[model samples]
Target: MTHPLRRGAAYAIGGAACFAAMSALVKTVGGDLPNSVVVFFRNAFALLVLLPWIAWSPGKRASFSTRRPGMHLLRATTGLAAMYCFFYALSQMQLASAVLLNYSQPLFLPFIAWAWLGERPPLRIYPAVLIGFVGVILILKPGMGWAGPAGIAGLAAGILAATSMAAIRRMSDTEPAVRIVLWFSVLGTLVSAVPAAMHWQTPSPTQWSALAGLGVIAAGGQLLLTRAYALAPAAHIGALIYTTVLFAALIGWLVWGERPDMLSGVGGLCVIAAALIVVVMRQRGSRTARA
Candidate 1:
Protein backbone atom coordinates (compact mmCIF):
# COMPACT_ATOMS: atom_id res chain seq x y z
CA MET A 1 0.00 0.00 0.00
CA THR A 2 1.13 3.53 -0.65
CA HIS A 3 1.98 5.22 2.59
CA PRO A 4 -0.68 7.71 3.59
CA LEU A 5 1.77 10.50 4.24
CA ARG A 6 3.45 10.11 0.87
CA ARG A 7 0.14 10.02 -0.93
CA GLY A 8 -0.97 13.08 0.96
CA ALA A 9 2.33 14.71 0.10
CA ALA A 10 1.73 14.09 -3.59
CA TYR A 11 -1.72 15.62 -3.40
CA ALA A 12 -0.47 18.59 -1.43
CA ILE A 13 2.32 19.25 -3.91
CA GLY A 14 -0.04 19.02 -6.84
CA GLY A 15 -2.40 21.40 -5.13
CA ALA A 16 0.47 23.80 -4.49
CA ALA A 17 1.43 23.95 -8.16
CA CYS A 18 -2.16 24.53 -9.16
CA PHE A 19 -2.48 27.28 -6.59
CA ALA A 20 0.70 28.88 -7.86
CA ALA A 21 -0.70 29.04 -11.36
CA MET A 22 -3.95 30.44 -10.05
CA SER A 23 -2.07 33.14 -8.14
CA ALA A 24 -0.27 34.17 -11.32
CA LEU A 25 -3.57 34.40 -13.14
CA VAL A 26 -5.05 36.42 -10.29
CA LYS A 27 -2.24 38.92 -10.53
CA THR A 28 -2.56 38.99 -14.29
CA VAL A 29 -6.26 39.66 -14.18
CA GLY A 30 -6.43 41.74 -11.04
CA GLY A 31 -4.67 44.54 -12.86
CA ASP A 32 -7.77 45.15 -14.99
CA LEU A 33 -10.59 43.58 -12.96
CA PRO A 34 -11.71 43.95 -9.38
CA ASN A 35 -10.81 41.33 -6.83
CA SER A 36 -14.43 40.53 -5.94
CA VAL A 37 -15.26 39.96 -9.60
CA VAL A 38 -12.31 37.63 -9.93
CA VAL A 39 -13.44 35.76 -6.85
CA PHE A 40 -16.94 35.43 -8.31
CA PHE A 41 -15.81 33.99 -11.62
CA ARG A 42 -13.33 31.77 -9.86
CA ASN A 43 -16.02 30.11 -7.75
CA ALA A 44 -18.64 30.08 -10.50
CA PHE A 45 -16.44 28.45 -13.08
CA ALA A 46 -15.06 25.96 -10.58
CA LEU A 47 -18.59 24.72 -9.92
CA LEU A 48 -19.26 24.41 -13.61
CA VAL A 49 -16.11 22.28 -13.94
CA LEU A 50 -17.13 20.14 -11.00
CA LEU A 51 -20.63 19.60 -12.38
CA PRO A 52 -19.59 16.94 -14.89
CA TRP A 53 -17.32 15.22 -12.43
CA ILE A 54 -20.08 15.03 -9.87
CA ALA A 55 -22.31 13.62 -12.59
CA TRP A 56 -19.90 11.17 -14.25
CA SER A 57 -17.60 9.79 -11.58
CA PRO A 58 -18.47 6.30 -10.47
CA GLY A 59 -20.66 6.37 -7.38
CA LYS A 60 -20.84 10.10 -7.83
CA ARG A 61 -24.51 10.18 -7.21
CA ALA A 62 -23.77 9.79 -3.54
CA SER A 63 -21.34 12.67 -3.42
CA PHE A 64 -24.01 15.16 -2.51
CA SER A 65 -25.74 12.86 -0.06
CA THR A 66 -24.01 14.51 2.81
CA ARG A 67 -25.32 14.67 6.35
CA ARG A 68 -22.89 17.35 7.40
CA PRO A 69 -24.42 20.35 5.68
CA GLY A 70 -23.47 22.62 8.57
CA MET A 71 -19.84 21.63 8.33
CA HIS A 72 -19.84 22.17 4.60
CA LEU A 73 -21.59 25.49 5.04
CA LEU A 74 -19.04 26.65 7.58
CA ARG A 75 -16.17 25.50 5.41
CA ALA A 76 -17.53 27.30 2.39
CA THR A 77 -18.17 30.57 4.22
CA THR A 78 -14.70 30.65 5.76
CA GLY A 79 -13.16 29.65 2.46
CA LEU A 80 -14.97 32.44 0.67
CA ALA A 81 -13.70 34.96 3.19
CA ALA A 82 -10.17 33.72 2.75
CA MET A 83 -10.51 33.87 -1.02
CA TYR A 84 -11.48 37.52 -0.84
CA CYS A 85 -8.62 38.34 1.49
CA PHE A 86 -6.05 36.50 -0.62
CA PHE A 87 -7.11 38.01 -3.94
CA TYR A 88 -7.17 41.46 -2.35
CA ALA A 89 -3.67 40.88 -1.07
CA LEU A 90 -2.56 39.67 -4.49
CA SER A 91 -3.82 42.89 -6.01
CA GLN A 92 -2.14 45.08 -3.41
CA MET A 93 1.36 43.52 -3.21
CA GLN A 94 4.03 41.78 -5.26
CA LEU A 95 3.11 38.20 -6.12
CA ALA A 96 5.98 36.71 -4.14
CA SER A 97 5.27 38.68 -0.99
CA ALA A 98 1.55 37.86 -1.13
CA VAL A 99 2.21 34.17 -1.76
CA LEU A 100 4.86 33.94 0.94
CA LEU A 101 2.56 35.51 3.49
CA ASN A 102 -0.39 33.31 2.51
CA TYR A 103 1.69 30.14 2.67
CA SER A 104 2.36 30.91 6.32
CA GLN A 105 -0.73 28.76 6.99
CA PRO A 106 1.62 25.99 8.07
CA LEU A 107 2.55 28.07 11.07
CA PHE A 108 -1.05 28.38 12.27
CA LEU A 109 -2.43 24.92 11.45
CA PRO A 110 -1.28 23.20 14.63
CA PHE A 111 -2.81 25.76 16.93
CA ILE A 112 -6.08 25.93 14.99
CA ALA A 113 -6.40 22.17 15.08
CA TRP A 114 -5.67 22.08 18.77
CA ALA A 115 -8.38 24.61 19.54
CA TRP A 116 -10.95 23.26 17.12
CA LEU A 117 -10.27 19.54 17.01
CA GLY A 118 -8.30 18.86 20.16
CA GLU A 119 -5.37 17.54 18.17
CA ARG A 120 -2.22 18.57 19.98
CA PRO A 121 0.80 18.35 17.70
CA PRO A 122 4.28 17.19 18.61
CA LEU A 123 6.33 19.76 20.48
CA ARG A 124 8.96 19.71 17.74
CA ILE A 125 6.57 21.42 15.34
CA TYR A 126 6.66 24.58 17.49
CA PRO A 127 10.23 25.42 16.59
CA ALA A 128 9.56 24.51 13.01
CA VAL A 129 6.62 26.89 12.84
CA LEU A 130 8.66 29.67 14.37
CA ILE A 131 11.40 29.12 11.81
CA GLY A 132 8.87 29.31 9.01
CA PHE A 133 7.55 32.66 10.29
CA VAL A 134 11.10 33.88 10.59
CA GLY A 135 11.47 33.02 6.94
CA VAL A 136 8.40 35.13 6.27
CA ILE A 137 10.03 38.05 8.06
CA LEU A 138 13.11 37.64 5.97
CA ILE A 139 11.00 37.65 2.85
CA LEU A 140 9.04 40.76 3.84
CA LYS A 141 11.88 42.68 5.49
CA PRO A 142 9.02 44.69 7.07
CA GLY A 143 11.06 47.83 7.75
CA MET A 144 12.07 47.88 4.10
CA GLY A 145 10.19 48.64 0.88
CA TRP A 146 7.48 45.97 1.29
CA ALA A 147 4.27 48.01 1.77
CA GLY A 148 3.42 48.12 5.46
CA PRO A 149 -0.38 47.65 5.36
CA ALA A 150 -0.49 45.29 2.39
CA GLY A 151 2.02 42.95 4.02
CA ILE A 152 -0.11 42.85 7.14
CA ALA A 153 -3.18 42.15 4.99
CA GLY A 154 -1.33 39.23 3.45
CA LEU A 155 -0.59 37.89 6.91
CA ALA A 156 -4.28 38.11 7.77
CA ALA A 157 -5.11 36.28 4.57
CA GLY A 158 -2.90 33.39 5.66
CA ILE A 159 -4.65 33.07 8.99
CA LEU A 160 -8.11 33.08 7.43
CA ALA A 161 -6.99 30.61 4.79
CA ALA A 162 -5.62 28.30 7.48
CA THR A 163 -8.91 28.52 9.36
CA SER A 164 -10.80 27.55 6.23
CA MET A 165 -8.36 24.66 5.69
CA ALA A 166 -8.87 23.33 9.17
CA ALA A 167 -12.60 23.29 8.47
CA ILE A 168 -11.87 21.24 5.36
CA ARG A 169 -9.83 18.78 7.43
CA ARG A 170 -12.72 18.22 9.80
CA MET A 171 -15.32 17.90 7.04
CA SER A 172 -13.16 15.39 5.19
CA ASP A 173 -13.62 12.96 8.02
CA THR A 174 -17.23 12.31 6.97
CA GLU A 175 -17.67 14.03 3.62
CA PRO A 176 -16.81 12.91 0.14
CA ALA A 177 -14.40 15.23 -1.64
CA VAL A 178 -16.87 16.23 -4.34
CA ARG A 179 -19.52 17.07 -1.80
CA ILE A 180 -17.20 19.35 0.07
CA VAL A 181 -16.13 21.06 -3.16
CA LEU A 182 -19.69 21.37 -4.41
CA TRP A 183 -20.80 23.18 -1.28
CA PHE A 184 -17.90 25.55 -1.33
CA SER A 185 -18.37 26.34 -5.01
CA VAL A 186 -22.07 26.95 -4.72
CA LEU A 187 -21.69 28.99 -1.58
CA GLY A 188 -18.76 31.02 -2.87
CA THR A 189 -20.62 31.91 -6.01
CA LEU A 190 -23.58 33.15 -4.02
CA VAL A 191 -21.51 34.99 -1.46
CA SER A 192 -19.38 36.78 -3.98
CA ALA A 193 -22.19 37.72 -6.36
CA VAL A 194 -23.19 41.00 -4.74
CA PRO A 195 -19.64 42.22 -4.34
CA ALA A 196 -18.73 41.15 -7.83
CA ALA A 197 -21.78 42.86 -9.27
CA MET A 198 -20.95 46.03 -7.43
CA HIS A 199 -17.41 46.11 -8.81
CA TRP A 200 -18.04 44.50 -12.19
CA GLN A 201 -15.89 45.40 -15.16
CA THR A 202 -16.04 43.71 -18.51
CA PRO A 203 -12.91 41.65 -19.09
CA SER A 204 -11.21 41.69 -22.46
CA PRO A 205 -11.14 38.33 -24.27
CA THR A 206 -7.65 37.63 -22.96
CA GLN A 207 -8.61 38.44 -19.39
CA TRP A 208 -11.72 36.29 -19.72
CA SER A 209 -9.52 33.40 -20.74
CA ALA A 210 -7.35 33.98 -17.68
CA LEU A 211 -10.35 34.07 -15.37
CA ALA A 212 -11.66 30.80 -16.78
CA GLY A 213 -8.26 29.19 -16.32
CA LEU A 214 -8.19 30.39 -12.71
CA GLY A 215 -11.45 28.59 -12.00
CA VAL A 216 -10.24 25.30 -13.43
CA ILE A 217 -6.98 25.53 -11.51
CA ALA A 218 -8.83 26.41 -8.33
CA ALA A 219 -11.04 23.32 -8.65
CA GLY A 220 -8.09 20.99 -9.06
CA GLY A 221 -6.25 22.54 -6.13
CA GLN A 222 -9.30 22.37 -3.88
CA LEU A 223 -9.88 18.71 -4.61
CA LEU A 224 -6.25 17.83 -4.04
CA LEU A 225 -5.97 19.84 -0.82
CA THR A 226 -9.16 18.36 0.59
CA ARG A 227 -7.99 14.84 -0.24
CA ALA A 228 -4.58 15.40 1.30
CA TYR A 229 -6.01 16.73 4.53
CA ALA A 230 -8.41 13.81 4.64
CA LEU A 231 -5.61 11.30 4.29
CA ALA A 232 -3.49 12.73 7.13
CA PRO A 233 -3.41 15.31 9.88
CA ALA A 234 -3.40 18.90 8.60
CA ALA A 235 0.06 19.70 9.96
CA HIS A 236 1.61 16.66 8.34
CA ILE A 237 0.96 17.91 4.81
CA GLY A 238 0.75 21.64 5.53
CA ALA A 239 4.48 22.09 4.98
CA LEU A 240 4.30 20.51 1.55
CA ILE A 241 2.00 23.30 0.45
CA TYR A 242 4.91 25.76 0.82
CA THR A 243 6.14 24.50 -2.52
CA THR A 244 3.67 27.01 -3.92
CA VAL A 245 6.08 29.79 -2.93
CA LEU A 246 8.90 28.41 -5.01
CA PHE A 247 6.57 28.09 -7.93
CA ALA A 248 5.31 31.63 -7.30
CA ALA A 249 8.87 32.94 -7.22
CA LEU A 250 9.52 31.38 -10.62
CA ILE A 251 6.37 32.91 -12.06
CA GLY A 252 7.08 36.29 -10.49
CA TRP A 253 10.62 36.42 -11.85
CA LEU A 254 9.91 35.28 -15.39
CA VAL A 255 6.63 37.03 -16.08
CA TRP A 256 7.02 40.22 -14.05
CA GLY A 257 10.80 40.76 -13.79
CA GLU A 258 10.52 40.82 -10.01
CA ARG A 259 13.51 39.56 -8.08
CA PRO A 260 13.99 39.03 -4.37
CA ASP A 261 17.26 40.31 -2.93
CA MET A 262 19.81 38.18 -1.04
CA LEU A 263 18.07 38.52 2.30
CA SER A 264 14.73 37.39 0.83
CA GLY A 265 16.44 34.42 -0.80
CA VAL A 266 17.83 33.35 2.56
CA GLY A 267 14.40 33.75 4.11
CA GLY A 268 12.79 31.61 1.42
CA LEU A 269 15.33 28.92 2.18
CA CYS A 270 14.52 29.12 5.88
CA VAL A 271 10.81 28.70 5.17
CA ILE A 272 11.45 25.72 2.93
CA ALA A 273 13.84 24.21 5.45
CA ALA A 274 11.35 24.61 8.26
CA ALA A 275 8.67 22.84 6.25
CA LEU A 276 11.08 20.06 5.20
CA ILE A 277 12.06 19.45 8.78
CA VAL A 278 8.42 19.09 9.77
CA VAL A 279 7.67 16.71 6.92
CA VAL A 280 10.71 14.54 7.56
CA MET A 281 10.12 14.41 11.28
CA ARG A 282 6.46 13.68 10.70
CA GLN A 283 7.41 10.78 8.46
CA ARG A 284 9.63 9.37 11.16
CA GLY A 285 6.88 9.78 13.70
CA SER A 286 4.44 8.06 11.37
CA ARG A 287 6.76 5.07 11.22
CA THR A 288 6.92 5.00 14.99
CA ALA A 289 3.15 5.16 15.22
CA ARG A 290 2.76 2.31 12.79
CA ALA A 291 5.20 0.21 14.78
Candidate 2:
Protein backbone atom coordinates (compact mmCIF):
# COMPACT_ATOMS: atom_id res chain seq x y z
CA MET A 1 0.00 0.00 0.00
CA THR A 2 1.01 3.63 -0.49
CA HIS A 3 2.10 5.67 2.52
CA PRO A 4 -1.14 7.64 2.76
CA LEU A 5 -3.20 4.54 2.49
CA ARG A 6 -1.04 2.84 5.11
CA ARG A 7 -1.44 5.73 7.53
CA GLY A 8 -5.17 5.86 6.89
CA ALA A 9 -5.44 2.14 7.53
CA ALA A 10 -3.53 2.44 10.76
CA TYR A 11 -5.75 5.23 11.99
CA ALA A 12 -8.91 3.46 10.88
CA ILE A 13 -7.90 0.19 12.53
CA GLY A 14 -6.82 1.98 15.66
CA GLY A 15 -10.16 3.75 15.77
CA ALA A 16 -11.88 0.43 15.31
CA ALA A 17 -9.92 -1.01 18.21
CA CYS A 18 -10.84 1.90 20.43
CA PHE A 19 -14.53 1.51 19.56
CA ALA A 20 -14.45 -2.25 20.14
CA ALA A 21 -12.88 -1.65 23.54
CA MET A 22 -15.43 1.03 24.38
CA SER A 23 -18.30 -1.29 23.50
CA ALA A 24 -16.77 -3.99 25.66
CA LEU A 25 -16.65 -1.56 28.57
CA VAL A 26 -20.28 -0.65 27.92
CA LYS A 27 -21.31 -4.27 27.88
CA THR A 28 -19.44 -4.87 31.11
CA VAL A 29 -21.07 -2.03 33.04
CA GLY A 30 -24.30 -1.58 31.14
CA GLY A 31 -26.09 -4.09 33.37
CA ASP A 32 -25.57 -1.84 36.38
CA LEU A 33 -26.72 1.40 34.70
CA PRO A 34 -29.61 2.58 32.60
CA ASN A 35 -28.96 3.14 28.91
CA SER A 36 -29.78 6.81 29.40
CA VAL A 37 -27.21 7.12 32.17
CA VAL A 38 -24.62 5.38 30.04
CA VAL A 39 -25.43 7.64 27.10
CA PHE A 40 -25.21 10.73 29.29
CA PHE A 41 -21.78 9.87 30.63
CA ARG A 42 -20.55 8.99 27.19
CA ASN A 43 -21.46 12.46 25.92
CA ALA A 44 -20.91 14.45 29.12
CA PHE A 45 -17.44 13.17 29.82
CA ALA A 46 -16.49 13.48 26.16
CA LEU A 47 -17.52 17.13 26.31
CA LEU A 48 -15.44 17.54 29.44
CA VAL A 49 -12.41 16.22 27.61
CA LEU A 50 -13.05 18.45 24.63
CA LEU A 51 -13.56 21.54 26.78
CA PRO A 52 -9.94 21.66 27.87
CA TRP A 53 -8.68 21.52 24.31
CA ILE A 54 -11.03 24.26 23.22
CA ALA A 55 -9.89 26.40 26.11
CA TRP A 56 -6.28 25.88 25.14
CA SER A 57 -6.67 27.02 21.53
CA PRO A 58 -8.18 30.36 20.62
CA GLY A 59 -8.90 29.17 17.09
CA LYS A 60 -10.67 26.08 18.32
CA ARG A 61 -12.66 28.09 20.82
CA ALA A 62 -13.82 30.43 18.08
CA SER A 63 -15.13 27.46 16.18
CA PHE A 64 -17.88 27.22 18.78
CA SER A 65 -19.78 29.83 16.81
CA THR A 66 -21.75 28.16 14.05
CA ARG A 67 -24.40 29.40 11.68
CA ARG A 68 -26.00 25.99 11.45
CA PRO A 69 -27.27 25.28 14.92
CA GLY A 70 -30.22 23.38 13.53
CA MET A 71 -27.99 21.00 11.60
CA HIS A 72 -25.93 20.37 14.68
CA LEU A 73 -29.04 19.62 16.71
CA LEU A 74 -30.27 17.22 14.07
CA ARG A 75 -26.96 15.41 14.09
CA ALA A 76 -26.89 15.25 17.86
CA THR A 77 -30.45 14.03 18.21
CA THR A 78 -30.06 11.26 15.67
CA GLY A 79 -26.68 10.25 16.99
CA LEU A 80 -27.95 10.13 20.57
CA ALA A 81 -30.90 8.00 19.53
CA ALA A 82 -28.52 5.68 17.72
CA MET A 83 -26.38 5.48 20.82
CA TYR A 84 -29.36 4.54 22.96
CA CYS A 85 -30.30 1.70 20.65
CA PHE A 86 -26.71 0.56 20.29
CA PHE A 87 -26.12 0.56 24.04
CA TYR A 88 -29.31 -1.38 24.68
CA ALA A 89 -28.30 -3.90 22.05
CA LEU A 90 -24.91 -4.22 23.63
CA SER A 91 -26.42 -4.86 27.02
CA GLN A 92 -28.86 -7.45 25.79
CA MET A 93 -27.00 -9.22 22.98
CA GLN A 94 -23.65 -10.88 22.48
CA LEU A 95 -20.81 -8.39 22.11
CA ALA A 96 -19.77 -9.23 18.56
CA SER A 97 -23.31 -9.48 17.27
CA ALA A 98 -24.27 -6.09 18.66
CA VAL A 99 -21.14 -4.48 17.27
CA LEU A 100 -21.66 -6.07 13.87
CA LEU A 101 -25.21 -4.79 13.69
CA ASN A 102 -24.11 -1.29 14.61
CA TYR A 103 -21.28 -1.32 12.08
CA SER A 104 -23.85 -1.95 9.38
CA GLN A 105 -24.39 1.82 9.33
CA PRO A 106 -22.57 2.13 6.03
CA LEU A 107 -25.15 -0.01 4.27
CA PHE A 108 -27.90 2.50 4.92
CA LEU A 109 -25.85 5.61 4.23
CA PRO A 110 -26.48 5.65 0.49
CA PHE A 111 -30.23 5.51 0.81
CA ILE A 112 -30.18 8.12 3.55
CA ALA A 113 -28.07 10.40 1.40
CA TRP A 114 -30.39 9.94 -1.52
CA ALA A 115 -33.49 10.81 0.45
CA TRP A 116 -32.08 13.66 2.46
CA LEU A 117 -29.67 15.29 0.01
CA GLY A 118 -31.09 14.25 -3.36
CA GLU A 119 -27.79 12.54 -4.15
CA ARG A 120 -29.01 9.53 -6.04
CA PRO A 121 -26.75 6.51 -5.83
CA PRO A 122 -25.51 4.48 -8.78
CA LEU A 123 -27.60 1.61 -10.14
CA ARG A 124 -24.95 -0.96 -9.23
CA ILE A 125 -25.43 -0.20 -5.52
CA TYR A 126 -28.73 -2.05 -5.55
CA PRO A 127 -27.07 -5.46 -5.79
CA ALA A 128 -24.70 -4.52 -3.00
CA VAL A 129 -27.63 -3.50 -0.85
CA LEU A 130 -29.28 -6.82 -1.54
CA ILE A 131 -26.19 -8.74 -0.51
CA GLY A 132 -25.94 -6.71 2.69
CA PHE A 133 -29.55 -7.46 3.65
CA VAL A 134 -29.02 -11.14 2.99
CA GLY A 135 -26.22 -10.97 5.51
CA VAL A 136 -28.49 -9.15 7.94
CA ILE A 137 -31.10 -11.85 7.54
CA LEU A 138 -28.60 -14.59 8.19
CA ILE A 139 -27.20 -12.86 11.21
CA LEU A 140 -30.66 -12.25 12.56
CA LYS A 141 -32.11 -15.57 11.56
CA PRO A 142 -35.03 -16.78 13.72
CA GLY A 143 -33.10 -19.67 15.21
CA MET A 144 -30.23 -17.46 16.22
CA GLY A 145 -32.29 -15.86 19.00
CA TRP A 146 -31.22 -12.50 17.60
CA ALA A 147 -34.56 -11.73 15.92
CA GLY A 148 -36.00 -10.45 19.18
CA PRO A 149 -36.15 -6.99 20.70
CA ALA A 150 -32.39 -6.68 20.93
CA GLY A 151 -32.02 -7.42 17.23
CA ILE A 152 -34.53 -4.75 16.31
CA ALA A 153 -32.74 -2.29 18.53
CA GLY A 154 -29.43 -3.14 16.90
CA LEU A 155 -30.87 -2.65 13.43
CA ALA A 156 -32.46 0.62 14.44
CA ALA A 157 -29.12 1.81 15.66
CA GLY A 158 -27.62 1.30 12.22
CA ILE A 159 -30.39 3.19 10.47
CA LEU A 160 -30.29 6.07 12.91
CA ALA A 161 -26.54 6.19 12.64
CA ALA A 162 -26.85 6.47 8.88
CA THR A 163 -29.12 9.44 9.29
CA SER A 164 -26.66 11.07 11.64
CA MET A 165 -23.89 10.45 9.15
CA ALA A 166 -25.93 12.05 6.39
CA ALA A 167 -26.35 15.12 8.53
CA ILE A 168 -22.61 15.20 9.06
CA ARG A 169 -22.02 14.97 5.31
CA ARG A 170 -24.37 17.86 4.70
CA MET A 171 -22.32 19.99 7.05
CA SER A 172 -18.90 18.71 6.14
CA ASP A 173 -18.21 21.44 3.61
CA THR A 174 -18.69 24.19 6.18
CA GLU A 175 -18.02 22.50 9.51
CA PRO A 176 -14.66 21.43 10.78
CA ALA A 177 -14.37 18.15 12.61
CA VAL A 178 -13.74 19.79 15.97
CA ARG A 179 -16.83 21.97 15.69
CA ILE A 180 -19.00 19.09 14.64
CA VAL A 181 -17.79 16.89 17.47
CA LEU A 182 -18.12 19.70 20.00
CA TRP A 183 -21.71 20.49 19.12
CA PHE A 184 -22.63 16.83 19.11
CA SER A 185 -21.10 16.39 22.54
CA VAL A 186 -22.80 19.48 23.94
CA LEU A 187 -26.23 18.76 22.50
CA GLY A 188 -25.96 15.04 23.12
CA THR A 189 -25.22 15.62 26.79
CA LEU A 190 -28.12 18.03 27.23
CA VAL A 191 -30.66 15.94 25.32
CA SER A 192 -29.71 12.69 26.99
CA ALA A 193 -29.68 14.34 30.40
CA VAL A 194 -33.49 14.31 30.57
CA PRO A 195 -33.84 10.57 30.31
CA ALA A 196 -30.74 10.08 32.40
CA ALA A 197 -32.24 12.15 35.16
CA MET A 198 -35.49 10.22 35.00
CA HIS A 199 -33.74 6.89 35.22
CA TRP A 200 -30.99 8.12 37.52
CA GLN A 201 -28.98 5.67 39.56
CA THR A 202 -25.88 6.49 41.50
CA PRO A 203 -22.88 4.55 40.30
CA SER A 204 -20.09 3.12 42.41
CA PRO A 205 -16.58 4.63 42.22
CA THR A 206 -15.28 1.81 40.00
CA GLN A 207 -18.19 2.22 37.64
CA TRP A 208 -17.55 5.94 37.48
CA SER A 209 -13.97 5.30 36.41
CA ALA A 210 -15.14 2.87 33.74
CA LEU A 211 -17.66 5.35 32.44
CA ALA A 212 -15.06 8.12 32.32
CA GLY A 213 -12.71 5.86 30.44
CA LEU A 214 -15.50 4.96 28.06
CA GLY A 215 -15.98 8.60 27.09
CA VAL A 216 -12.31 9.30 26.70
CA ILE A 217 -11.77 6.20 24.62
CA ALA A 218 -14.70 7.13 22.42
CA ALA A 219 -13.28 10.62 21.81
CA GLY A 220 -9.97 9.12 20.87
CA GLY A 221 -11.69 6.79 18.41
CA GLN A 222 -13.50 9.70 16.80
CA LEU A 223 -10.28 11.61 16.39
CA LEU A 224 -8.53 8.65 14.89
CA LEU A 225 -11.35 8.09 12.39
CA THR A 226 -11.46 11.74 11.39
CA ARG A 227 -7.72 11.74 10.78
CA ALA A 228 -8.03 8.57 8.75
CA TYR A 229 -10.44 10.13 6.32
CA ALA A 230 -8.23 13.16 6.08
CA LEU A 231 -5.28 11.02 5.08
CA ALA A 232 -7.01 8.98 2.38
CA PRO A 233 -10.20 8.62 0.43
CA ALA A 234 -12.86 6.73 2.34
CA ALA A 235 -13.00 4.04 -0.32
CA HIS A 236 -9.31 3.19 -0.12
CA ILE A 237 -9.35 2.60 3.61
CA GLY A 238 -12.98 2.32 4.60
CA ALA A 239 -12.88 -1.46 4.64
CA LEU A 240 -10.48 -1.31 7.57
CA ILE A 241 -13.23 0.24 9.65
CA TYR A 242 -14.83 -3.17 9.80
CA THR A 243 -11.97 -4.31 11.96
CA THR A 244 -14.17 -3.22 14.82
CA VAL A 245 -16.15 -6.39 14.29
CA LEU A 246 -13.04 -8.57 14.46
CA PHE A 247 -11.84 -6.84 17.59
CA ALA A 248 -15.29 -7.11 19.12
CA ALA A 249 -15.42 -10.79 18.29
CA LEU A 250 -12.08 -11.30 19.98
CA ILE A 251 -13.22 -9.46 23.08
CA GLY A 252 -16.46 -11.43 23.14
CA TRP A 253 -14.67 -14.73 22.88
CA LEU A 254 -12.11 -13.92 25.51
CA VAL A 255 -14.36 -12.27 28.03
CA TRP A 256 -17.68 -14.04 27.44
CA GLY A 257 -16.91 -17.16 25.35
CA GLU A 258 -19.13 -15.80 22.62
CA ARG A 259 -18.46 -17.45 19.28
CA PRO A 260 -20.46 -16.74 16.16
CA ASP A 261 -22.16 -19.61 14.38
CA MET A 262 -21.29 -20.52 10.81
CA LEU A 263 -24.29 -18.73 9.36
CA SER A 264 -23.65 -15.50 11.19
CA GLY A 265 -20.00 -15.64 10.27
CA VAL A 266 -20.89 -15.92 6.60
CA GLY A 267 -23.40 -13.19 7.03
CA GLY A 268 -20.79 -10.87 8.46
CA LEU A 269 -18.54 -11.52 5.49
CA CYS A 270 -21.36 -10.68 3.11
CA VAL A 271 -22.13 -7.47 4.92
CA ILE A 272 -18.50 -6.42 4.91
CA ALA A 273 -18.20 -7.13 1.21
CA ALA A 274 -21.34 -5.23 0.38
CA ALA A 275 -20.24 -2.20 2.36
CA LEU A 276 -16.89 -2.23 0.61
CA ILE A 277 -18.59 -2.35 -2.76
CA VAL A 278 -20.79 0.59 -1.86
CA VAL A 279 -17.84 2.64 -0.69
CA VAL A 280 -15.79 1.89 -3.81
CA MET A 281 -18.64 2.63 -6.15
CA ARG A 282 -19.31 5.96 -4.53
CA GLN A 283 -15.64 6.89 -4.67
CA ARG A 284 -15.45 6.02 -8.37
CA GLY A 285 -18.54 8.01 -9.16
CA SER A 286 -17.11 11.02 -7.36
CA ARG A 287 -13.91 10.71 -9.36
CA THR A 288 -15.83 10.46 -12.62
CA ALA A 289 -17.72 13.63 -11.80
CA ARG A 290 -14.48 15.42 -11.07
CA ALA A 291 -13.00 14.24 -14.35
* Best prediction by TM-score: 2
Tell me the RMSD of model 2 versus the true structure.
1.7
Q: Please report the TM-score between candidate 2 and the true structure.
A: 0.95
Residue pairs with clashing backbones, model 2: none
The true-versus-predicted C-alpha distance at residue 182 of model 1, in Å, is 1.2
- Count clashing residue pairs per candidate: 0, 0
lDDT against the true structure, per candidate, is: 0.81, 0.89
Clashing pairs in 1: none
Residue 139's C-alpha lDDT in candidate 1? Answer: 73
Give, for candidate 2, the lowest lDDT window spanning 10 residues: 53-62
The local lDDT score (0 to 100) that residue 211 gets in candidate 1 is 95
TM-scores across all candidates? Answer: 0.84, 0.95
